[model samples]
Target: MKRQGGFTLIELVVVIVILGILAVTAAPRFLNLQDDARNSALDGLKGAIAGASGITYGKAAIDGVESLENQTISAGNETINIDFGYPADLAALEAVVDGLEADWSNAASGAAILFGYDGYNQRCVSYTPATGANVPAVTEVIEGCGTNF
Candidate 1:
């Protein structure tokens, strides 16, 4: 009888079965990365919004435009709309933050920007500016917008 040098059929079948099992168990873990990335992006955007507001307010204060409404300031070539020394609208926020490619919708008080990921629109950040102050309230809408990720 001749000796075989390759893997036997039983051995190959067992190997394939183990690989299938591993894939079945691990696939879901990797699939959720899109949602995680979206969440991270939202956090970063929130921070950016806060930082931009502060910087713009600082510039407005320096230029003596804190009491001026609808004033525009040039922040690194981007024009930011100022209202009482704070960011006024989505356009102003986007101008200071830059590179935000999410879809925006006008809210009752301010604006909401929606970022889609993992086939859901669950990530939303809302900006609502106060009437008499330079502080804008930012809210992260994790529920009621779409499926929570």
Candidate 2:
């Protein structure tokens, strides 16, 4: 009698069971990565908005543009609308950042806009124009971002 060069049926079954268990344990971690990625992207957008606001404000000051509603100033190659020497609205913030795509909604008071990414339904970046001597504010909301993806 010759022994076959193959796994026994019991051994194969055990191997499959182990693989199934591993997959069951690992699946959730992999599934959650998409949400993590979306959160990270939103964080990056927040940083970009803050940086753009600062740079645009500096440029407006250097060019002697008065800090007033509806005034526009050149920042790098893009024009940023100003509200008291800060980014005026969502459009101005989008202009400063350039090439960023998101859904925008006006805030209740119309003093800010909420920019949300398509896949990240709950996550948003809020852009609030400066009031009085205060600088513009950019806030990121990652906690309420839906995990539909």
Candidate 3:
């Protein structure tokens, strides 16, 4: 009797079934990376905003105008306008720090500046400028971070 070298049919079927199971379990994790990326981007943006707000407030305090609203101060070549020691608006913050406009869009709503990721303005960070008595409030709406509006 000649000895055949090919594997049994059952072996191929088992390999295919294992691959399918792996794909089923791993696909979702890879798919969710987009969501994770967007969320992380928003978080980084929030951190930048918070840092800028703090720095601007420090500058305002140094000028002895921390409690005053609608004040402008010069840091390097950038002119930062502040309200109650916090960057008055997104524009002011952008002056203190760059690149926000490159990837993000913002709008003013009531007492806060709403910054949306990419073009989805609804899913973003809401930055409320300082009210003299407290630090600027930085909050986010990531529930729709990776989804289309």
Candidate 4:
């Protein structure tokens, strides 16, 4: 009789069960959902802000206020105040996007949020008003994955 170099069905089943148990108990520790979510949210917000700034610039150009400071542009039902063809402040950025204030808070004049992060300012996005033919700056502070938002 020749010995087979293969696992029996019972042995394979036991291996699979052990793997499943380890996956169940260990996957969560490896996959950090909260950090992923916060990073995604911040990225989405940065896109929205950049887009809104462009739209505001277009409107400002049409109205001949693109180079001027402390100007207002009509966007939908809201009048967005702008500076140098982009949003003037955090309030102006918030005007175009809804649900931002729910999780985000103003950290400074041109920055937003201290979103329950374990690391130092790794969960915030900075928004600077445009000036001198420059568009508004939207950036995320990326450090590393953390415990929660």
Q: Which candidate achieves the best lDDT against the true structure? A: 3
For candidate 2, lDDT tens digit of each residue in 73-145? 9756777778777788766777877555443333322565666555556676667778754555555554553
Provide the TM-score for each candidate, comma-separated: 0.63, 0.71, 0.82, 0.66
Judging by TM-score, tell me the better candidate of 1 and 3: 3
Q: Could you arrange the candidates by lDDT from highest to lowest? A: 3, 2, 4, 1
lDDT (Cα, tens digit) per residue for candidate 1, span 1-149:
99889999999999999999999999999999977876776677667767777788889889888777778887776777888888787677667766754543333322544433435556655556534554554545444455332
Residue 9 lDDT, candidate 3, scale 0-100 = 96
Against the true structure, what is every candidate's RMSD?
4.5, 4.0, 2.9, 5.4
Backbone clash count for every predicted candidate, in the order shown: 0, 0, 0, 0
**Overall local distance difference test of candidate 1:** 0.66
Model 2 residue 66 lDDT?
Answer: 46
Candidate 3 segments whose C-alpha is farther than 4 A from its true place: 2-6, 119-122, 135-149
The candidate 3 region of ten consecutive residues with least summed lDDT is 140-149
3 against 4, candidate with superior lDDT: 3
Each prediction's Cα lDDT score?
0.66, 0.69, 0.75, 0.68
Kindly list the per-residue Cα lDDT of model 4 for residues 41-84, writing each as its tens digit: 77787676667767778888999999888889888888888888
